[model samples]
Target: MDSQKRLARTAGMYYLIVAVLGAFAHIVRAQVYVPGDAAASADNVVAKASLVNHSFVADLVQATFLVFVVMTLYRLLHHAGKNVARAMVIFVVIAVAIICLNMIHQLGALLVATDPAYAAAFGVQGSEALVLLLLDLQHFGYLVAQIFFGLWLFPLGLLAIRSGMFPRLLARLLMVASAGYLLDVLLQFLTPELADAVNPVLVTLFSVAEGSMLFYLLIRGVRTLRPAEQAVLAA
Candidate 1:
């Protein structure tokens, strides 16, 4: 009904879209990627070329919508802390840039998997290896982008906590989620065996934290600022 509520809902809507599409793309990739078996992975990709294409499109769309999510949140939260809001936007921008560039690896994988010219030039075995390599690059590139993804949440949590318009508990959960993301990335890169053991818990934490924020923004919106709180923020 009011401008703040409208903006909150808009941000929630965009966030929801980005989440769904990103999940879809990830699911598709997981289905096709065979971990270490390049031939099997290539076969899977070739068999599901259409699905892979759709996933690529989903990833691009997700990246685009992610920008909207952060920008809308920035507009709504900027009054809480101008520098933190700007930092959130900057982090998202960097993440989005990495995501867009990362898509090239996905495209390369698809091309190497499906196009006859690649097979003819490189031989089937070689082409398949290239596909696997490209997909590997794409996966690691996403993790690199995720570093900023987690960093953005820290500033977002700070803004939410400072705003006096959202629950402090939820804001704190977001900060915890930020730490979870960073830790997940660290474990994934440094100690993958340990990461495999720990990642499920981290994923659950991230989901709970982000899911709570998404639902609150969509359903309850932000609470109205009290006159006293507004005066303090203005000062």
Candidate 2:
């Protein structure tokens, strides 16, 4: 295949990886976490240690692959606008760093759940609370990372619009989705009660915006590149 197609496929592969792993992580967490019940959450984790371990590993893998996804996107979109592309990469890098760091809390939760030392020190109930607290930190850390996630999208959407390689409407919707991301993050931090209220709508928009881009890359690749661009890819 040609450069654009190759890049598209590669990106799609990584995106799908990230999506699958991320979904699995959420699924495992959901299986164990009772939202507000620490004791129940701990019991679930202890009982399903394998699932919790899998979730942490999945998260780490997803975060690592996300960096490659950002790099490939930057390579594809930089020609459209160097500054915006650079900004996009920067935001994604920061977000990835935050996400990777957040995984430590997941590890901490696992340790608190499984380690005998923690059990001895805190006792069962206290250990469960600590695990829940660590997981909560991971959740909040993700919210903070979402700020950079949203920032990256603005430039990505802008580049998509300007590049002429993608549908204009898709690009426009991406910007709208970016707004949703920003709004969601703000609500999460500023008015957490309101965050849950708007989460479904925002998540829907995000899924549409991102899913469209992913499908486009996987199915259509990009519009045929100019000769010079094709030459660069060949090199």
TM-scores, all candidates, are 0.97, 0.92
Candidate 1 residue lDDT tens string, 147-212? 999999999999998987689999999999999999999999999999999999999999999999
* Per-candidate count of clashing residue pairs (backbone under 3 Å): 0, 0
Model 2 lDDT, residue 53, Cα: 94
Best by TM-score: 1
TM-score (C-alpha) between model 1 and the true structure: 0.97
Q: In candidate 2, which residue pairs clash?
A: none
Which regions of candidate 2 deviate over 4 angstroms? Answer: 224-235
Candidate 2 structure quality by residue, lDDT tens digits, 1-235: 3786788778888998988999899899878877678998788888999989989999889989989998998888898889999999999899999999998988888889889899899888899899899888888899899889888888988998777677888888888988898899889889989999999989999999989988888988877757885666456
RMSD of each: 1.2, 3.4
